[model samples]
Target chain A: MRLIELQRRMAADVMRPLSSRAPGVSTYLTPNTLLTAADRLDIYHRQYWLRLLDALAEDFPALRALLGERAFSNLSKAYLASCPSKSFTLRDLGSKLPSWLKADLGRAGKYGALALELARLEWAHVEAFDAAWIPPLDSAALASGPDLRPTLQPCLRLLELSHPADEIRLAANQGTLRREKLSVGTHPAGKYFIAVHRLDGDVFYRRLEAGEFQLLRRLERGLSLGESLAGRIRGLNDPETAPSKLRTWFEAWTVLGWLGE
Target chain B: MPANKFNGFTDLGIGVGLRIPHYDHIFSQAPAVDWFEIISENFMVDGGRPLAVLDRILEQYRVVQHGVSMYFGSAGRLNREHLRRLKSLVRRTKTPWLTDHLCWGSVDGKYTHDLLPIPYTFEAAKITARKIREARDFLEVPIAVENVSSYAEFKMSQMTEWEFLGEVVERADCGVLLDVNNIYVSSRNHGFDPMAYLSAVDPARVAQFHIAGHSQFEKYTLDTHDHPVIDPVWALYAEAVARCGRTATLLEWDDRIPPFEEVHAEARKAEKYLPEAAAECA
Candidate 1:
């Protein structure tokens, strides 16, 4: 057989379910003294899938938690079939997961949206944690004025989420989450605008108010300081987003180094 | 220490793989590590903690780049994007040489994301060697192709593993990062004599040595890189050192990693087989 054909066959064989007859082993794989050809080939087969599976599990713990162990494992198996890792880094393993989950809910139909949102957030955390460093606006520039246009640090991720998946993610990280209790319909539900950013070489998160989230969103898009604040101020007609809140949010944002300082 | 034949690559003394578990210990204590070998793909990201941590480590120690995804034997055009990122890192670390396994890891555009074995036929060697030469010319640095542990053998493999390896390195005009433990692991898996395999390799092409552990199952041993160097593997390293004289060596403990000191001490064990380490002790 041709090299490419052989490789294609081998790739399929390794990813095949264990119960399957281990395809494409003959002609190429030799049955050595100690192990049969199929058994010998199974070692690489097991390692190939297991290692990638472990990386996927590590990358999206909350989604895994929400889906339960067995369901999540199955979901990943499907995900890899659709989107086998193309990047050299295993970090990109889950790059297509959110979309994959969105298109095909699999067994978690009712919780699909929540799972999708959680998957998005977790992937954002992965991207933000090691994203290329962009020096925040210097303290001097930040101190210059509230007049400064907003720019986000490269490591910052601003996400608008429904279902408060961050809370569940926290639970997952803390190991306090019960996989049995999690679902889209019955699980904790709420709208949350959150920031996931790295500080002092560690990843952390905090909840943001509607107005605060919007202001940061605008600023992140390279909006002027006045423009973002004015956009938020326009919402002052509502009690929750009154003009009085902008100043306090700005103070907090600047202090947290969210204002590109 | 004997200077490497290619580009005078230094024999970076016994070193441990730079792992995440030991990062705190590595960064804080600044342990007396001779050098570090990183899975080049892990640090090839665009500006994150991995790069930051690598940058900091590069400051205090000698670091070499070992890649898992080069897939030199894979059919079709090399991934230019992958090569670009690798070159950027090469510039950053100024690694004396870059190494990846001599195997085909991807087919078409899809990657299996694991080190997949290649046939040892002369046809396979001709194609693989050409790709190796292309990679060497493009990277403008010494490139060493490692022999990966394998579970299956190609029926059409017209030559032995060492013969195929020698052909690839010789035709590509590249160096060889002879991984000793892999030799032991593959020998058991394929029923080959490890000594004959070692002797078959051209000593001048041997640039570095990798010492790692393997997990033995009922039938075959898996190259887990999760345990200490077994006595047989150590003995193989001794033979490799005897053949190549002084060579750069690294200990890989990627799974269930122990403390920094423990991993370093494991790397230090290769010293007993070294004539220089013996000379110094005397």
Candidate 2:
């Protein structure tokens, strides 16, 4: 057989879903004394799923916690089967997962909305953990009114979620979250604006007020100061106190190294 | 002594894989280790903890980049973005030479992420060698291809693994990161004399050696790299050192890793095998 053809066949054989019957491996593989061709091929097949599954589990521990082991395993298998990695690095294995979860909400059942929010938050954590670092715009730089064109740091990920996924993920990290304790009664529907950002090589999360979230989202969208605050922010009820509130948020952002030029 | 024209042949004696579990100990205690072999892919990130930790390690030790995802035998052009990120890392670490597997892991742009065995045909060898050479030229660094411990062999293979390895390396004009544990694992699985595989490799091209552990199942030995270096693997390393001279050696313990002291003690055992070879290199 030709090299490419053989590789394609072997990759297909290895990547065949584990539950399905083993592919015809004896045709391409050589049998040995102890192990048959099928047995040998099974090793690679198991490794393929195990490696990708393990990587996804590491990246999405919160998702795994929410879905529990069996469901998460099924979701991972289906996700991988549908979206096998296309990147060179395994770090990118979960790059499309949030979108995939959003697209396949039915599979998540009762935990669909919460699971989707958790997936988005987890993916944001991954991005914030390793997104490129840029020098922040210092308070001095922000003081220059005429030339103050601020941008959010690359390592900052602003997420608008319908559930408090960040709190669950923190609980999961701290070993305080119980799978049994998670329920719709426990976590009522609530809107959350979370900023996941990296600072000094550590990832952190901060809950943002609706006005702050809107302003930062606008700045993240490359809106100038005039444009970012020109329109009334959706949750900013009092326009009289908006200046002081915006000033406080900008000061906090500048101090946290979240603003870049 | 072997020529190792790859990078003027520096023998970095006795190193362990830079693992995450040992980070606090490594930073706080600052042990007197010879060097570290970093999995290149782990640090191939845009920025953040991986690079931050790597920068700290670089400040203290000589770090060699050993990669697992090059997939030289994979058909198609190499991923340009991967190479660009890898080159940036190479520039950062200033690794003397870089090592990745001589196996294919991806096909048709979808990565299996597991190092899959290559059919040892002349055509496969030709393609793999070209990719290795291309990567070497682009990275502007010496490239060494490591033999992976594979379970299955291809029916279309025209040569033995050792012969295929020789053909690829000779054609590519590259160095060999000869993992002796892989030889032991492959030997047990395929019923080949491990010594024959070792002796077939050109000593002059050997740039480094990897000693690791494997798990024995009823049918085959898997490259687990979680246990201590078993006796047979150590014996293979002894023979490899005898043949290849005192090349750089690294102990790979990826799972169930012990404390830094314990892992370092396990790596330091290479000194027993390197006495004569060390003198020869000197």
Question: TM-scores across all candidates?
Answer: 0.92, 0.97
lDDT tens digits by residue: candidate 2, A164-231: 88899998888777767676345556788899999888888899998899888888888777777776
The sequence of per-residue lDDT tens digits that candidate 1 reaches over residues B149-182 is 8888888788899999999898889889899999
Please give the lDDT score for candidate 2. 0.89
Q: lDDT at B277 for candidate 1?
A: 41
Model 1 chain B weakest lDDT span, ten residues long: B1-10
The DockQ scores of all candidates, in the order shown, are 0.65, 0.86
lDDT of 2 by residue, B1-282 (tens): 444667446767789999999999999999999999999999999999999999999999999999988899998779999999999999999998899999998889989999899999999999999999999999999999999999999888999999999999999999888999999999999999999999999988888899998899888899998899999888998889888777788999999998999989999999888888767657
Give the TM-score, chain B only, in order for the candidates. Answer: 0.96, 0.97
CA error at residue B9 for candidate 1, angstroms: 3.3
Model 1: reference contacts kept, as a fraction: 0.71
Give candidate 1's TM-score: 0.92
Q: Which candidate wins on DockQ? A: 2
Q: What is the C-alpha lDDT of each candidate?
A: 0.81, 0.89
Q: Which candidate has the top score in lDDT?
A: 2
